[model samples]
Target chain A: MNKPSVFDDFYSVIPAGGIGSRLWPLSRADAPKFLHDLTGSGKTLLRDTWDRLVPLSGVDRIMVVTGRAHRAAVEEQLPDLLDPNVVLESEPKDSSAAIGLAAAILLRREPNVIVGSFAADHVIKDMRGFRRAVAEGVAAARAGYIATIGITPTDPAIGFGYIQCGDPLSIAGAPNAVTVRSFVEKPDLETAERYLAGGDHLWNGGMFIAKADVLLEQLGKAEPALLAGLTELAEAWDTPRRGAVVDRVWPGLTKVAIDYTVAEPAAAAGKLVVIPGDFDWDDVGDFASIAKLHSGGRKSDLAILGENARVLADASTGVVISQSGRLISLIGVTDIVVVDTPDALLVTTTANAQRVKSVVDALKLSGRDDVL
Target chain B: MNKPSVFDDFYSVIPAGGIGSRLWPLSRADAPKFLHDLTGSGKTLLRDTWDRLVPLSGVDRIMVVTGRAHRAAVEEQLPDLLDPNVVLESEPKDSSAAIGLAAAILLRREPNVIVGSFAADHVIKDMRGFRRAVAEGVAAARAGYIATIGITPTDPAIGFGYIQCGDPLSIAGAPNAVTVRSFVEKPDLETAERYLAGGDHLWNGGMFIAKADVLLEQLGKAEPALLAGLTELAEAWDTPRRGAVVDRVWPGLTKVAIDYTVAEPAAAAGKLVVIPGDFDWDDVGDFASIAKLHSGGRKSDLAILGENARVLADASTGVVISQSGRLISLIGVTDIVVVDTPDALLVTTTANAQRVKSVVDALKLSGRDDVL
Candidate 1:
């Protein structure tokens, strides 16, 4: 099978560090979101993502970069990748700081090797399509380009920030690639609907592929001090106390998202390329978003038992995920969402789902880990 | 303290032998409604009634007349009442026949003693008031008259039939005595409201106190054959072959309520005397009525909790009776009745509480005795 491949010596650094609080109750600080079996089936999101990456590289070729807090979990999740090679951040830092560190560390060992970064907590249903995108990303990275797979808009999904692709990259027999125009922040309903209808904006899947050399050179050009510090730190990675050395050098690092640190600036530099991807993808942000991914809005519109029991059953109103232990009988509940964990239950309207974070915030302010 | 002593020389015979499909999922052939601990206070209605009657009578004076199927449970409930004298029924006979039998049998031992016949599944609050009423009933019976303590009307409670007192008996020094004008059938809300306003009508509390001689004489005047056969059987009650003899004689008895068979006729004949009872009482005919007895009313309610987790908040508009071992939370329910037993739960608006019998009818047709 003449499958397309990434740059010959590429490193896929999957970041699994973020202590995602938006998916609270189900996801906890001690056991983060990536570890949850959201599907109700046994496999976790990180496990699925790791399996997707395995065919492209060997044990040493793939490196996972996570927080020091998550190193043991990462080792346990991907046993084959557990070694001195895997990078654990000294202190919890922004994604770009970790990304820059991974790039600098990998470049020293395989100077020509490409770098691919992925968020660990994502669901990509179309693995074959994703594999093809990875192969395309590796090719682009070899050509000294920063490559990001932008998913074709399926809905006016406002949960994700979008990327606007400018023109198609024409290469016969190759998957259609595009030159990216500009990044778009997460939009309101009207803007998201316009992006969906306009057919240019794509969901930014947070999976980027670029060569280690290109990433370093760009960092040097864009943030020379940050690049210098990461390089110095990577040089002593295998020396005495690698993490301790990085911890000593970490205080001066800038705190910013990778999108803000590099992707936004690099896209403005005219070298950023976007490839059209047909993969069924999700970042799985919160309970509301995770619910959508679980059913995919494709089939299974949940209908609680009705009629015989007095209830306000208007389909347009809201979805209720209430405290119906083994069996939940919903009566007279209208336009509300109810989610029951073994402990606390969450009840609000779907219109207020995004603001459910405020509930968590209030709960945290009240010092209620028992609820959140 | 000279507390006016209320004597239960009167045997409290709860006639639960009839096939009560009206109380399905609770009153089954094997385990009737009287067997269930509906109070959720670790006491069955029969047991609660028995306890209530304890202050009034000796253990021998408390008999539960149930079917052959419920003998074991009845015995189990009152291990003390299992001394053969506490349970009496003619293998699931109708109330008329059971009452006929009750009168004849009790007369053999306590020939001139008053027997107060009551149902087991009724709920009574204001125990002090109930005790005073029972005392009034005992006093009225002592004066050579058949006495039935009638509850003063609080509303036009259409669920119960009513009695209109003609006038005071013109007796000197009688504080709460009345002559029976006639018994009224259950009426509509307008009629019931009027009855409450008139201050002369009483809800037939289904509690009757009369000398065994008076009850037998009334039975003789009405169903002479039933009364005569039962009298003949009464002489042979302590005989070894009593069950076989009862089987032979009981089939000849007609299926009629005691009110229709004797009480109404005697009242029509101007021989019935009424004594107004001051007691917080309920027949607990359905789950809805049963709930009100717990919560008091919608305005003033009570809660049932477990291990600090409140299981139910009972109200007049709605009541929740929970089975132990599960957490229950009810929201926004009004005028609804909820009975949660181990096997199944019943949820119905109390307005349709009379139609709750329809649910029982359906269960009976489906042959779901496990639920019952």
Candidate 2:
């Protein structure tokens, strides 16, 4: 099940989008979550994700699907990416159209090829475990199933969706893979605790692998109009008509997530399988989660992000500082997050970090784009 | 007894020293608290204090004692100040020398003139009440007793000294004036509560009035060396030898407060009186006090100290923002103070606002003068 041969036919398709409004003042629309290095590492999340998948899929085998606004940034960040391999959607039509368009484009190039879609903003610390999980998923995909890599629940986190394992799949290299019974939405604390205690549920990390034709077949079964539009754009993708085709077709595509349009429906039809991932994973969703990641799994302490930050904390704990080269002093303040930028500052307690999205909404309502 | 006649002979001396370290980032060493409008008013604290006293003391009768570095700013802020009235100290030598030099300089011209010393940064909200109190203090001064304006206790605050009042003085035009029994240092909460419970105690506002010759005579009795240095400087004050005499003698003068060198000793000699001030007053010593002032005497709420600041708050109370024309977002944080400047920002709770001075001290220790 852990054989390296499973990675031979795998291709990586990264769906890079999402402004991550919950991490606002640090994550803006122009420079989003994927473009930022939230883990204090020198590399951005997109680049880190690219580096992680490069071993399995070489530079030419990896494709990135992003909005037209971010196409330049993606190309600038990943220099080796070929122009044809960079799928630029004219506008955002949700994850379903983005991934379906990438699949359709890849199917036009090579039929029956296995394409794995991973988000660009997620952080994967355990590379070996991630590769093993992806290999298992790819093997399951080859066995004619839409396979998803689900993270083993380390904590009863209510912020993520869950996948329930029904029965074990009998794929050759994916002996640990199981048939997904149901895909549940983000649960409450009680349901999350029950899922953790049951041990049959895993956090859906939103990673999926399937044959390009199989994914298009699922999209065609679910949303025929979206599938037809993606197919038409794919037909003109490498031709001189790509710009006109994308501009005409992208706006009419149904704006829905793949999880709702395909995964849930496919799971009802016994077409979805789950491969359990044992690696550390985070989407870097909010400042509180970021504080936890920066603390290196510590209970309560300071989490600093930049190099020029000089912090003096006294009688304070759980202070997350995304510094802007300024000296910050925290005294007697606990469980607070301070994101200091050149133009804007966000100060809040960990309890209210999730409400930061509404702040962005308010800013948009007021037309404050200078900070937005 | 609160006649307008006592104000005609009264001269005002404003000792503008202390850098106000507790309100750092807004009140810097270069631009101290007196120069800032902490109340969101258009005028600075010094200008407000000057305007409040203009009815009692004409612009020509007011004298300002400030550090040599602040001389230019003080002159620019108060253009009506005559050249000889601007007493510029080469270095800070505390309140005793600053006030004593002012008294000696005034004594050289008019020996029997009553002089009042008020800090440049203190806020007086009720001008009529303040003027009445100053007039009563001037009457007590004419009656041959050094008089101090003591505020009616609004709260049991431990940050200020308490004045003990004895029998009421039977002097003309000063019916509310009482002989001062003693001046106690800043008390603990229990002692402050006890003092508040007793109606005989008043909060010392650090405002004093006495005849120019009487203050000089008291200084001569307490610290002869300081008095001698001040007298020699005063004799050379209007002459060409002023610079030479000041350079030789100013540094050797004892650095002490007027309360210790003159008021306490004068009270022990039964030559001091206290005139109760029935007005709203605050020293604006720390951020918590500033927050209270900015709240306009309300219980607990958000207080903003700048016009250009744009704030977004959610489920928060007791927040104070001194903005630097930047947008600040606060979520689910209570009792916090945020002072945002162009170069530095300070975020702390109301309870720990007094600890800001230590933060400035730490900044100085780390050689962060750019932020300090």
Candidate 3:
């Protein structure tokens, strides 16, 4: 059911503290994946996400939560985001800590403020469906139940974690929301296939909409140390010594995702319910995701020839990316990913793009960022 | 016998009238292989050949015989050779026509002169041995015999024609002079291997040294029409309208290789003599010849990678030349050639190098000189 957008003070909690090392050269310490225009279409993922978020939330209400190091990059791309609302984590904390910090900041300002905890670097295909799910979650959060939006599983994707559905929720007026049975980490290929076959599982994409107080309460009960540090960091945010204060506390926290610290435990207690959204959401964790977003339905008709061609594949030939966009005329290349960066190149079968991160990890260990 | 340096009037005859479609872009109509520093080295083939010829022939006596189209390129490279002796044919009329033309020119003024026919684009390794052979041929030519400097056979190379050696001629007063032998066209792979194993076979390198009058007599009997045309062309060459004179008679002469009309026929008639020259000689007709010249003995060791590559190859995966001299690195490339030139590129295996000329022919048929 479509619902009209209604929020007193809509807040955006853009978590950009994590280093997207998986994206490498395009997502370096200087300019993360969210800041770079990977599509070559000029609009960066972060900027596009902001453009989508700003229309729903007024310009003054928008906040970009990031690390102190990324302030300049975030500021450069998003001039529309309020400088005071652009909250920096006292240190490089996990996503759960960042969410807690955003929750503490917005709850102190407005008791029922809908804090949208969105990723800065995802490519969402259906904005309307996404907004509808977000609106439903925001509405649900105000009613004291924590809400998360999950994407309908289309493939047996082993890279993504799965959220199993329980019985339909008893919440009034929101029939589409379901009680979450459990949160599963990235499944094995066999489990992923079964999930695809079972049809009750949705990919646990990192998207959430909740009232600041509900999330803070969940954070306090699920991860108390994270909640306390987040409260102190949120209060100290924007102060001259806030970065130093957050940095000291950040290293002490366990590096855990929100699902492990809150959603899984909250589901066990029967408090976490997810709204199944067919918004075509993707975390864009690897070349495979990028290929899906780019291929649309034309995956079979694409032929990319170059040095560093990050292409997705099926049973046929794959893609090639060459350096400097040089003329990559392939006569005999097939079913293989050909990556040509300036310093190095990679050629492997499409079934192995998941292992491409192994190359990235090797590059990091080998200290070949000049190539990475 | 390494004889005295005196009593030898060394006059070099550079044969530049052969069509080099095999070399393609690097050996185009305007700036053939002789004019290029293909190895990225400072000196060109013509420059290197001339450097070697200058000390033996004295820069004053070094003459180049090329087609009119390539005359300017040759003269431009060796401006000092632009004297009356630098012969330029209006059209490529093969080595038979070229040698006859040189013979007629040298006959009038330089009596007992030793004319050494040298290709401007062949790659030879051992310059000292080559000079020794030429000096020996010059001494032999003074004693009256049609002399061919034969390369010591290294392998069963089907790419080159072979010469059968006979008993050495007793020079009487001279040593290291050989008499009448036989010449054979490029045999099949099996025949070449057998020839290599049988011994007494030499690579019939196009290099020849002989007295002007002796060459005149041989051409008169071997190819009468070519010999007469050369005599007429040389006579008219002293006149003001030499270009028109040569072009008028050029179409009348038979277009045949020097091996067929002179070397083979002369050998079959029991008049062909050869002197063994111990030099690493290669015609450099295709990539196999080029591979031998590269220090690593293969272009595979000299790879440059690029993300985007446009190459002009002499063979299928043979010699890759990129148009942009920019860095081009190949990651998982093997047994392939990549080349880049400003106008064109080729990508093919070295196995298909001989068929590289087919690319030019295809372009010509398609009316694409822009790429050809």
Name the best candidate (by TM-score). 2
Candidate scoring better on TM-score of 1 and 3: 3
Q: Candidates 1 and 2: which is better by lDDT? A: 2
TM-score-based ranking, best first? Answer: 2, 3, 1
lDDT of 1 by residue, A181-238 (tens): 9888889999999999999989998877888777767666777777778888889986
Q: Whole-model Cα lDDT per candidate? A: 0.67, 0.86, 0.68
TM-score to true structure, per model: 0.60, 0.94, 0.63
Q: Can you list the residue pairs that collide in candidate 2?
A: none
- Candidate 1, DockQ score (0 to 1): 0.06
The count of residue-pair clashes in candidate 1 stands at 7
Worst 10 residues of 1 chain A by lDDT: A305-314
Off by over 4 Å in 3: A1-302, A305-372, B1-10, B16-31, B38-41, B67-82, B89-100, B111-114, B132-204, B210-228, B243-260, B267-277, B284-292, B298-300, B303-372
lDDT of 3 by residue, B17-37 (tens): 655677665567666778765
**Residue A237 Cα positional deviation in candidate 1, in Å, after optimal superposition:** 2.4
